[model samples]
Each structure stands twice: as structure tokens, then as C-alpha cells.
Target: MLLLELVETTQTVASTRSRLAKVDALAHLLRRLDPAEIPTAVGLLSAKPRQGRVGVGWSTVAAAKEEPAAKPSLTVADLDAGLDRLLATAGTGSGAERAATLRKLMAAATAPEQSFVTGVLLGELRTGALEGVLTDAVARASGRPAGAVRRAAMLSGDLGGTAMLALTGTEAELDAVGLVVGRPVLPMLAATAASPSAAVEATGEASVEHKLDGARIQVHRAGDDVSIFTRNLADVTHRLPEVVQVVRSLPVRDVILDGETLALDEEGVPRPFQETMSRFGADAVRETVLHPWFFDVLHIDGQDLLDEPLSVRIEVLERIAPAHRIPGEVTADPAVAERVSQDALAAGHEGVVVKAVESTYAAGRRGSNWVKVKPVHTYDLVVLACEWGSGRRTGMLSNLHLGALDPTGEFGEPGGYVMVGKTFKGLTDELLRWQTERFQELEVRRTAGTVWTEPVTVVEIAIDGVQQSPRYPGGIALRFARVKRYREDKAPADADTIQTLRALLRP
Candidate 1:
């Protein structure tokens, strides 16, 4: 398949707002892909390369300038070669040298091709379609059921590999082949129920676990050797030496456990999420304050418990896992679960996760087997303006200026609005680009390079709570306010009233 073919599909998908249509279009393209072309195709579709905040920018015009002596341009083979060279030079060169090499390779391609390469580098290809959509596409192309394709990919964490296997044989045959190969497959992470009623509806009986505020970790131990990794699969074995020591002491050998790593206070209460993140940088490994709490075991002693039900896995986890676990879990009663939720909040924890007893580990699927119940508070808000971002967010209006929604539905008048804060969180890069373009189209004022947008995106803000503010019209401010999602389904006229804000004011 030509790179242009994939690029056209991406452009079409990026322009479309209807997700179902996007999925259908992607599925059609996948069906037409040659089996041998799947790996390069997937690689092209998923590359997300990002430059740092500093350095020269590359626009179409910029790329056209200072053209090199039309040397033989990059091909698929060149991409592979470039990646090999990058890996070879990875830890040996200065950051600038690596960045320059990556930039040169990226510039050698056309715009769409550059987009593809960038996506691969950033580890996320936000073409508006997720794994399920891609799975459907693969199954349609390979003449297999979507469920089988999804399961195989879940087991392998490599969609291209799964697609290859599915095209050639049955899932059972693939599983047997996988066992023989003995390569580490994907770990099955816990899923969540979409709603409280969904949690009850899924399992006939529901159990609740305190949803501690921490980072998700997967620990793999073989004899005395232990490795700890974050949810994104980046190895952090050296960063948390204390946690590694704890895992090494567990009696079991050859086990994989899933849990949270937190920073705890003197009273054993968990520290803030930022504190845990602080222990992740280049110098973090030497810090000793990080603590871990093991919650589930997906594999132990060569027995893969992923196929087993949650209750069964919990039994195995309790038996072979470490004695120290996240404290205070209540089961089978919503009333008691509510009390536990209250206790968790009082103790400075996040909230509770109510899970179904019989739910199996659904790798990469947000299935309705677990439900997170966080305390929701509402804030009246106004849209100020959006800001441009760097790196993966280049040329995009990636951050928002948020203000309390004036009860009077007025701006610039007395007590009309308050500029509380700004946030770039909760937005995927694709969303950033879309918002940037939209903001430009809706620009009401312009200053320097910044454009003030029409206050059209009305949204309700949720946070842990509010804090006193020197800024903001309501004399209080939102804590950790982020775009939960665009309120496109909602009109500004329907925004939460100031009375709601008054009710939530801290005494």
C-alpha cells in the first residue's frame, strides 16, 4: 500500500466529526490492506513524533525553504533504517543531536507522512478511532470475528501481530503458539463500570474497593529479580528501589502483580498524586519515600489467571501477594460502601471503585465491570481564551482560560466574571488541533499572536474541592479544573447557575 493511501484516509477521518462514520471508513480501509503491509501500515497510522518546547519550528513553508540537494528521499525502508539508527544512538548522544536526527528524518517526508511519523514517536495516534474500531477493521480485513481479534490483541499488546496471526489461523491455535513462544503478553488491567446501576446490573452482587489516589503499576518478579512498570509500560524499576525491595521479599517467584504506588504521610494516609509523579524523573530513583500497595495478581507460578473471574483472582492475590495492601475495602453492600467512601475522603483519599465480583480482566477495555464514584462538585464557568501549545501540541490552541459562569450571563460587567485558571489537561492532541482551528474561526479579538475566542464552550467543572482565591469573581476558585469534555451537547444557556456555586462555597 502506498503511504499516500493511508494519509488520505487519515485526512478524511480527521475531518469527520461522526465517530461511527470514522470507524466504518477505517474498517473499510483495513479490509483492503495486504496482510504483509499491516505492520508498516499500523506503524504509520500510530506514529506521533513531538519536538520539545524549544527549537526551530517546521511549517510547510519552513520545510520548503533551504531544501537539501534533492537527495534520494525517504522510503519505508528509510523509516526502518532511521529507527534502527535512532535506537543505536539513543543514550550515547546529546539530546540536541538526537532531536536533529529525528527532525531531519521527519522533514524528509510530506506533511501527512510527517504526521504519521510524529504519531509513532509520541506513542499515540489520535486518528479519532480507538482500539475497538481498529479491531473491527482488522477482523473485517482478516475474515475473523471482532471479538477474537480483540482478545488476541489484548493478549499480545501488539495489534499488528494479532492481525497477522488471525489472518493465518484460529485464536486457539494462536494461543498455543503464544504459549510456546513464551513472550510476555499484555497485562490485563482492571476495567470500570460506566455507572453505579451498571455495576449492580453486571454482577448480581457488587464489591467496593477504595479508589486511592496513586499511580498504576505492574510488577513482574522472577526469583530475586523484580521489575516495576507504569501503566504505559515504561520500566521504572530503578526509580522506586524501596518498592523493588518490597517486591523482592514477596515469597512467590515468577509472578505478575498489579497495584498502585503512592507517597504516604506519617499517619499512613496517601500523599497527593503529584508527590507520586515527583518520584519518576531522572533523579527520582534515589528518593526513598515512594511506597507501593499491591491489589491484584494476573499471573502466578505459570498460571495465567486472566481468564479466571475477579473473585478467583482476588483469592490468589490475597494468598501469594504481599500482606500490605491498600487498606479499608468493603464488599457486597452499597450502604457500607458509601460509608467507606466517606471515610476515604475524610482520610484524604480520592474515592471508591465499586467492582463486579465475576468480572474478568478486560485488557485495554473500559468495560462496565468497575465503577469509580468520585465526589462531584459543580462550578459555574466562563470561557476566556485559549493558548497555543508546544511539542505534540504545536499550532494548536491546547489550553483554556476558565472563569466562573456569571449568573447574569454577562461579561465585563460588575461581578460578571472571574478568571480563575487555565488548563491543558483532558484534551487529546487531535482535540487540541480541532479547538485551535475552531477558536481561530470564532476569534472576536486579536492581540499579538493570541486570539480571544467567543465564550461559547460552556462547561461544568469538577474538582476535589475549591480553595480561597485572590482572583475569580466568586471570591473562590476551582482546584484542578479541567475540561471534563466539550459540552457540545450542552448550550451555554443551560450552564450551572451561580446558585449552585453558592451552595458549594466552602464555609
Candidate 2:
């Protein structure tokens, strides 16, 4: 298929907010793809090419400029072949070879196709069709059951591969895809709730477990070989020998465990989230060691418990790895749930996750069956600037640049604001339009992407917490920061001080 066809469909998907419209556009495009091109096309549209990241960064894409072709000629196969060339040169640091290939590819693509390819390469595509939506479209186009396609994708951790099979292979072959002991599966996700009691109310008779402020890991073991994967399904087995050792110590010959791992202090309290992430990004073991805490078991002794109830999985997990289990209690009482929440906070944990005991393991889905409740720290921060949005959010003022008042001038002048972080989340279309119009009126200067505004707009920002980072002048950054609301009632002088945010960096 022509690359322009896919680009047009992406535009269609982004132009509309309706799920049905997006699915219809995607399914229509999928039905037109040849068997050989289905996987590449799906991967490109999903912004998760089979070749993964081909070592291309924003600077390379921006620097290797090329005028768009006047007419469509590049095929999906042509694009995939170019990426294959890129993958071969990955980590070779041959910028000339990679840039030549990328510029040539861009020169062949039309304007729309060029933009789509750039977005895919940069991992910034905003087609509005998430994996679930695309899976539904794949099923719709192929006449396969949605559940079968979803399960295959969730288990295999490859939506592109699953789409190829669902479209071309028989229903028997697609359905036959099962939990493989050595392969990484998509970890189950959770929805957010206001409080533990609210979460328990959402998922009755729940397992209220302490929510560790750490990294999510999925461990798969067969015989003596064990592998650990991050939440994104990236293999980190070599970097996490401690996790592999703990999983290998289990009695079961074949098992799959899902849990969190973090470096703990001598007091056994969990370390900061960034400290654990630093180890995850390491090439090899470091002085900082991460310990595993298993909360749920997916497979045990060749038995696939993915379809089993949470209660059953917890029982099996407790039997197999009781010493490594996360602390929690199974209770229906709101008071008991509140106690668990308090206990988690007192233990230096994040919060509590209340999960329904009867809910089956719904991998890759953030259903209401499991709800996470964490306390949020809110502060009124001044909006220093706003960057231009992308794809569907284009032509809007999004991604607010936040700053905190540095009243004592410890990091800057007295009564000045120090840069903290930026966030584009928790925005509605109404808010987007409001900011686009309002911020431009308050603009003091402009750049290619951002409009610097007068430091008079005070916005209420909610953050999970603050972490130590040298990127900001304050020596800290906001973690999981999102807009609670625009603080129209508050002034820039009333914004929280940099000292207040710095205090969060303390234990």
C-alpha cells in the first residue's frame, strides 16, 4: 500500500474523537493492506515499529531536512526496508549513513507522509487510537473475535504481530497463542481512585495492598533461566540479577511473576523512584541493589493463571514467595481499607491499591477491577510558557512550563520564579482552546514551539511528589505532574515557594 494512504487514515483518526469513527477509518485502511505489508503498516501506525527505535533522535530528524515529494510514490515496503537499514546501523554511531538514509526516505515521502513518518520515529504520534482501539479495528477488519485478538496481543506483547496473524492466519492459530514461559507479557494496569475507601467501594471485597513507589517488573522463569522485563516489556534481565536470583529461588520450575522492585534503605524503606530508575537505566549492576516484592503471580509450574481470580493467584503467590510478598490485607470494610492506607504511608510506601478478589487478571487493561489510590501534592505554580501541541492537539497552547516562587533568592533573584517542570496532561478540549487564545494574549515573547507568557498566570498543579534532578535550578522536578485546575483566584505571588517543593526531596 502507498504510504500516503496510511497517512490519510492517521489524519482521519486524529481529526475525530469518536472511537467508532477512528476504528472505521483504521479498519478500512487495514483491509486494503496486502498480506506482506500488514505488519509493517500496523507497526508504523501504532508508532511501535517491529524494528523498535532505530537510534534516530529529534535532532537527527530535525537536521536532515528535505522537501516533500510532489506526488505519492513511496510504498509501505519501501519505508520498512529503510527502517531495516537503520536497524542494521543502530549503535554504530554512523550519523552520516543514518542521516543519508533518513533524508532519502523523507525526500521520497509527500508532506503528510513525511509528517506521519517523523511522528512515528519520534514516538510522538497522537492518532488517538490506543492499542485497544487498534486491536478492536483489527478484529473488525478480520472478522475475528475481539477478545481473541486482545488476548493474543496482550500475551505476545506485539500488537503488530498479533494484527498480522489475526488478519491473515486462521482463527485456530490465533486462538492457539497461549502464555509462553519465556516470553514477556503485557503487565496488567490499574485505574486511579481518590481514596482507598473509594477504591474498595469500586472493587468490592478487595485486596488492599501497599502501593510501593518503585518500578514495575514482570519475571518469566523456565527451568533455571529467568528474565525480567520493565512495564514497557523491555528486557532488563542482565541488569537485574538480584530479581532473577529471587525468582530462581522459587520452588516452581516454570513461573511468571508480576511485581515491583526498588532499592531499599537499611531500614527497609523504599528508596526514591528516580533512584530505582537510575539502576534500571544502567548497563550493568551498580552498588545500589534492587529487591523484588511479588504481589501477584501469573503462571506457576506451567499452570497459566492469567484467567484465574485475584484471590486464587494471591493464594498461589503467598505459597510460592511469601517472604517477598507485598504487605496487604483482604478486607471489605472501609475502615480496614483506611487502615491499610495509613499503614502504607507510615511504612514509607506510596499508598494502597484496592483490587477485587474475584476479578480475573485482565492484562493490558485498566479496568475498574483494580483501583490505585495515592495522595497527591498540589501547589499553585506560575505558568512561565506554553508549548505548541501536536497531531490532534495541534494549533493549541499545551504543555505548560511551570515555575515556583523563589522568595529567598536561594536559587535566583528574590521574588522570582524558578523552573520546576512541564506537563501537558489532564487537559480538556475546552481548556486547550482557552489556553491557546488566552496565553497568546499574555505572550511576552515567542519561539518556534513555545510562547513565553508574563509570569502572572497561577495554575494549580498536582504531583505524585518531587524528585531530585539537576535539570532544574531548584535541584528537583515534579513527578507525575498534572493540572488540577487553573487557579484564576490565585496570583503569582501566592504561588508555592521553591523551598516548599525542595522540602519534598527530603525523606
Q: Native-vs-model 1 lDDT? A: 0.61
The local lDDT score (0 to 100) that residue 321 gets in candidate 2 is: 95
Show model 1 residue runs off by greater than 4 Å.
15-37, 47-75, 79-126, 168-173, 177-204, 282-284, 328-330, 377-507
Model 1 agreement with the true structure over 1-507: per-residue lDDT tens digits: 555567677666655665566667776776667776666565454332212112222232233333332333555546655555555553554455656667677667766666555544433244544445566777776677777787777766677677677765676765543321123445443433333444445445655667777767778887788887666556778787888888878777777787787788888877755566566544545443877776667778777877788788778777765375655453665556667778878888767667677877776654457666667653436566888777877777877887654433233221234566677777866567778877776565667656676555665556655666667656565678766555442334334444444445557
What C-alpha lDDT, on a 0 to 100 scale, does residue 203 get in candidate 1? 49
Query: Model 2 clash pairs?
Result: none
lDDT of 2 by residue, 378-427 (tens): 67799999999999998999999999987545686445689999999989
CA lDDT of each prediction against the hidden true structure: 0.61, 0.85
Query: Which numbered prediction scores highest in lDDT against the true structure?
Result: 2
Prediction 2 global C-alpha lDDT: 0.85
Q: Residue 33 in model 1: shift from native, Å?
A: 5.4
TM-score result, candidate 1: 0.66
Residue 96 lDDT, candidate 2, scale 0-100: 87
